[model samples]
Target: MSEPTNLPVDPEPIREILKNHQQQIRLGLRMCAHCGLCADSCFLYRANDRAPEYMPSYKFLNSIGVLFKKKGKVGKPAVEEMGALVFENCVLCTRCYCPFGIDIPALITLGRRACRSQGVFRAYDK
Candidate 1:
């Protein structure tokens, strides 16, 4: 079998998209409860036998919650870390909304938007 090819990941466009939708994203993040309902709804969680990190709320917590707890006073490194979790792991697929009846992908997208506004997303290679 051939080896799997790794595709290039460009964070710039994701950042730009997020930047354009920051307010909506911020509002969505503010409404989450980390209730784990979204986790139950995640395919990743099901496939992985319920790893907490795969849960949508946990992922959101890792991104938005960290920023909120720090009140955006975090350093660049921390921001970058959170951005990776938000942008890389999340597909903005809206799958996690089933359990909680909440729009989690929207929330995640909003968080990404915030990251984009701060120039925290990865730069695309020309």
Candidate 2:
């Protein structure tokens, strides 16, 4: 595995994307309740069977929590990390469901969209 290189670019465009999709992002966050029922539906949790951090709600909370704490003043690095966790790891399969009938995968999709707006999407595969 090689170390990742940071790309040089202004984040203004990315910030605009995030700003444009703010409503959808907020909707996704509002759907979660930290119920933990979705834990069993996660592939990471099922595969490892040891790490609670693999749960979808936990992952979403960590990323979205940063936005809340900072009052939506996140920088590129923060958005990038959130994108990796929510997009790459979770699979966006909608298998994780809460007791209140919340769909975790859908919420993750919203997170990805928010991250994507900030140019936090994965690099193109060559």
Candidate 3:
């Protein structure tokens, strides 16, 4: 397996990329009701003993939510951290259900895109 490499952080392009998806991010962020109903549907959450961080809403809130809130001005380290949350933590399972009809997988995908712009992504062994 190759080691994960860090690319130099450039805030301008990251801002631009995120700007393009502003609408979806904003809608996803606003759609979550925070009722915690989706938690039980996640295998990771249940396998991990119901940790709050494993919950879909919690993951979205902490990663995508934080990225949008900061307006993509965060550094590489922050991006990497959020990458772990969205990329490593989530598999875009699409099994996570929101009674309010929120699209959790799409939002997580948005978070993945944000992380990719910063060169923070999952490293697979060849």
Question: After best superposition, candidate 1 residue 123: deviation in angstroms?
Answer: 6.2
Lowest-scoring 10 consecutive residues by lDDT in candidate 2?
1-10
Give the C-alpha miss distance for residue 25 in model 3, angstroms.
Answer: 1.3
lDDT per model, in order?
0.61, 0.64, 0.79
lDDT-best of 1 and 2: 2
Cα lDDT of candidate 1 equals 0.61
Prediction-by-prediction clash tally: 2, 0, 0
| Residue-by-residue lDDT tens digits, candidate 3, 94-121 | 8998888878887788778777766777
lDDT score, candidate 1, position 115: 70
Residue 72 of model 2 has an lDDT of 58
lDDT of 1 by residue, 3-91 (tens): 12243334454455545655655656666665666666677778877877677887766775565555555555655666776766666
> What is candidate 3's CA lDDT for residue 114?
72
The TM-score, computed over Cα atoms with residue i paired to residue i, of candidate 3 is 0.87
Query: What ranking emerges by lDDT with the best candidate at the front?
Result: 3, 2, 1
Question: Model 3 residue 116 lDDT?
Answer: 77
